[model samples]
Target: MITVSACMIVKNEERVLARCLDSLKGLVDEIILVDTGSTDGTKEIAKKYNCKIYDFKWIDDFAAARNFSFSKAAMDYIFVADADEVIDEVNREKFLTLKQHLIPEIDIIQMMYANQLEFNTTYNFDKEYRPKLFKRLRQFTWTDPIHETVMLDPVVYDSEIEILHMPENNHAVRDFDIFQRLIQKGTAFSEKLISMYARELFIAGEDKDFLTAESFFTGLLEQEVSEEVIKLIQCILVRCGRIKNDSELILRYALKNIATGKASAEVCYEVGEYFYNKDNIKEAVIWYMNAAFETDAELNIHYNKELPLEKIALCYEKAGNTEEANNYREQAAALRESLM
Candidate 1:
């Protein structure tokens, strides 16, 4: 059996820390909890699990704190989790099975990070696979202070395990604040950071920031980026253009995204939205159908699935096809019910 150490960096997570730690019981050989100056009872909760808790000075860099937690691990594999995340019962069983059958040569294990599990009024169900499990001997380390990711070899294995993130505290502007601070400190932005920064500004809801975000996103497209990141950046740029009421720019980015050999659901949906805004129901329906029928899981965001269905229903309604409109609405309702 491969020994696994659960490593986490936490601060002021008293309410959720115990719940997260409880889910890891009997699943890992050890738990290393690094507290970054928590005034709450988070350390006391960690004591209940017999976790090796250590205090680390609060630094702006999250990777530094994570690396410090990893340094205390003595197991063959290191598993990272946040205080706001929990492994469900089914995924916990899968995790145990994965631990038993894990190969030594697998440098990293990609697991689903289910950002939203059930449908709520605030956010839709969002999820993606991330490399959360790593081999200790591989010397993998986390990168970036914000949106940190592990540096690992290409030999990765996908696992059925899922980590459900349930955030109780709302730190909506925290990441944007960090990005601003990094910028003020003269920190050179990486391609990934640039994409994320643009996204933050766009979501910040400032009227003037949308134009700035569009400029940054336009610059991002000129740089070499991975297909997935390119799709995400294009999605943001298209949205920004739409919000800015720049029809030509929106069409340009939307067409560019579609021409990427594999237009993602978001790209298709945005195109549908663009045509719909122009009162072209027929053309909008075609693109919305493309988004609705998209089979590539990685290419579809959570909203991509539901939004297309909803838009298609509206398009059919506008086209005076009552039966088709009702059918599409029923399908959308069923999908929403299933998610709930």
Candidate 2:
């Protein structure tokens, strides 16, 4: 059987830490918990689990803390876990079974991460595959009999084990703070990070959040970027303009994308919101229809799906068209149910 070391980086997670450890009992050979300055009873709970706990100084970088925790693992495989995650009895059995039968050649294991929409975070999918287990040591082998070359890619396996991500609260505020700090330090954002930041803003960001992020996204427009990244930045600026009630900023970005015939659903939705608030039901309905059918969403998927549909329903109601309003409302409700 392959020995698995569960590694976790935590801070002030005393409330949920015990529950998470209890769920992992017997499934992991050892637990490595790295605390990043926790003043609560979190360390006491880790002691109860006999975890190999180490203190890591907070560096405002999650990757750094996670790497520190992984370095302490001493098993054949390392399983990255979070204090908010729980594996039920059925999945626990499946995990143990996999640990017993997993081949040595497989270097990575992916598991389903469920309950994403609970807090309406950046992720669009409610359940998606995430790499959770890694081989502690890698083997380099040559393949291709003639003119053999070293294999560079790791062998990966997807498992049926589902881990429930049940966070006590939404962490968007904390994440936004980190992103802001990174931006202040002049760190260049990867495309993935840019997209995630835009999605988080659209999903859970408040007016203050949008206002604070406006200048950063606006500055990005002055730099040369990919077409897709430009579209995402445009969407962010349009939303920011609407929140700040700056008509010039909103129209400047919105018109440019519309003229290119590549307007994203988020831009269309923002335009619809602009008109909707002005008591222009007809114009709002047109824009909402464009959002739902004419354009694809660049960030939040809801902009192209449920959000526009619900708004269109409201627009029809404002126009005194009960039949059309009910139809659109039913469509929106059905779409929501399908996601569930």
Candidate 3:
């Protein structure tokens, strides 16, 4: 069996820290908790878990903090998790099994990060594969100040484990503030960072921020970005146009997104929303139906599948098609029930 050290960097996470630590109690060999100026009882909570706690001064660099925490690991492998994340019983069992069978050649273990799960269905609100488990080595250091990630070798294995993130606050503005500070300090903006910065501003939804975010996203559209990122940029552009009440721009971007042949359910739903808001019931119904039936596996954001069904039901009701309306409503209800 392989020994695993659970590592984390946190501050003022007392609300969720215990939940996170409790979930890892029996799964890991050690717990390394690095506190960055916590003004709460987070350290006390860590002590309860018998975590090897160390204090570090705030440096406003997430990677530095993460690397410091990783340095304290005294096990064969490091398993990283945030203060608000948890490993459910099923995944914890799977993790133990993985440790028992893990080979020395496997440098990294990629697992699903279930960032959000739908209230009722088995559908995840948002999930992505990330390398959260890796061998303890000097060469594997985390990179990037914000949205940090490990530099892993190509020898990686995907695990059936999952880490569920349940954050109490959205922290949109707080993150945006960090990005802005980084920008002011003349940090080189990589394509990924630019995309994230634009997303933060767009989600902030301030009038001035929206204008700036729109410009940034527009600039990104012309850059050599991945198809997946292009789709996301286009989605944000569509939302920006919607905020400005520019129906022409919204339709243009939404159509472009669909033309990519990689459009997500949310992108299709945005088009449906445009037509629905304009009282074009027939056109809206087509797009809504498309969104409801979309089967793209690559889409990872908050694409509410039930929204389209409900919208189609409303469209049918407005058209005096009571039978069709009731049918779609029942479909939506059934889907929601399955989630629960």
Top-lDDT candidate index: 2
- Worst 10-residue lDDT window, candidate 1: 116-125
For 184-212, candidate 3 gives per-residue lDDT tens digits of 67665676676566445433446556665
- Number of the candidate with higher lDDT, 2 or 3: 2
Provide the clashing-pair count of each candidate structure. Answer: 0, 0, 4
- Roughly what TM-score does model 2 have, to 2 decimal places? 0.97
- List the candidates ranked by TM-score, beginning with the highest: 2, 3, 1
Residue 47 error, candidate 2, Å? 0.9
lDDT of 2 by residue, 20-52 (tens): 999999999999999999999999999999999
Evaluated at residue 188, the lDDT of candidate 1 is: 65
The window of 10 residues in a row where model 3 has the poorest summed lDDT is 116-125
**Candidate 1, residues 192-285: lDDT per residue as tens digits?**
6665564444334355555544555566567777777777777777777766667887788778877877776766776778789989999999
Best by TM-score: 2
The local lDDT score (0 to 100) that residue 313 gets in candidate 2 is 92
- Judged by whole-model lDDT over C-alpha atoms, candidate 1 comes out at 0.76
Error of 2 at 244 (Å): 1.8
